[model samples]
Target: GAGVSQTPSNKVTEKGKYVELRCDPISGHTALYWYRQSLGQGPEFLIYFQGTGAADDSGLPNDRFFAVRPEGSVSTLKIQRTERGDSAVYLCASSVQGARRTEAFFGQGTRLTVV
Candidate 1:
């Protein structure tokens, strides 16, 4: 795809259910990121993947959240035991891995509603 693509733009899951959000980054981009945004807050970094390995995952809230980029191209965020507080927009972004100044391109985001 020309730009970041996220599947299931909108998702509604019941509490205690599990959900998986997919992200297809721009072609050739090696730096991929996953973030979550609540109502009025800015996107909170969840994890960052450089190529096929996760470079940084410090922002992941707990063991229930995880992200992976097995092929260095597409990524997926997995959530377990979804809670009401987990309802938010999950955003995916990508940029050149080591360019001096590469701007990240973001997807429209997947709005996950946990009810």
Candidate 2:
């Protein structure tokens, strides 16, 4: 695609349902990231990929959250047993690796609402 693309711009689910969000980053970009934004706060890093490997996954709240980028391009975030606290905007960013400038371009985001 063109810029980053995220699926399910908005979602409403029960307090304990599984949800999957998709993201397609710009072509040829070597770095991809996922972030979570709660109300009245900045985006918090969730995970990052430098290619097919996960460069950083430290910000995930728990083991229930996971993500993958198979071809260093498109990625997906899988959440199991979603909780109300998990309701927030899920964002994706992509940038070139080691560019000194981490001007990450973000997608519109998926607003996941766990009722």
Candidate 3:
């Protein structure tokens, strides 16, 4: 019954700092996704997880971005050496099953501001 949840609704960090954003998906959902949204723009797909494995990680801009869902439930997005350009709203979503047809519910998002 619960929806996707993201922590630290807002984050402020220096250009070279590291940041870890957390997400908790709905119960029994088999598919999870991460997206980034810039000012006035649509959310961009980042990585997707089906069960405990990453199904698609191509959207990650570079090696500095990564995510993990070890036990197939909660996931964490890790950014190494954060840049000012990395500032954006990080959103998480989950679906009842892994399919293009199923609807995915989104979290409020963690807004990261790199100074």
| Maximum-TM-score candidate | 3
Compare the candidates by lDDT and give the number of the best one.
3
lDDT of each: 0.94, 0.91, 0.96
| Ranking of models by TM-score | 3, 1, 2
RMSD of each: 1.1, 1.1, 0.8
Candidate 3 clashes between residue pairs 3 or more apart in a chain or in different chains:
none
Model 2 misplaced regions, further than 4 Å: 98-100
Candidate scoring better on TM-score of 2 and 3: 3
Model 3: per-residue lDDT, tens digit, 32-68?
9999999999999999999999999999999999999
Candidate 2: C-alpha lDDT: 0.91
Off by over 4 Å in 1: 98-100
Which lDDT tens digits does candidate 2 get at residues 1-115? 7798999899899988999999988888889999999999999999989988898899999999999888778899999999999999999999877366778989999999999
TM-score of each: 0.96, 0.95, 0.98
Task: Compute the lDDT for candidate 1.
Answer: 0.94
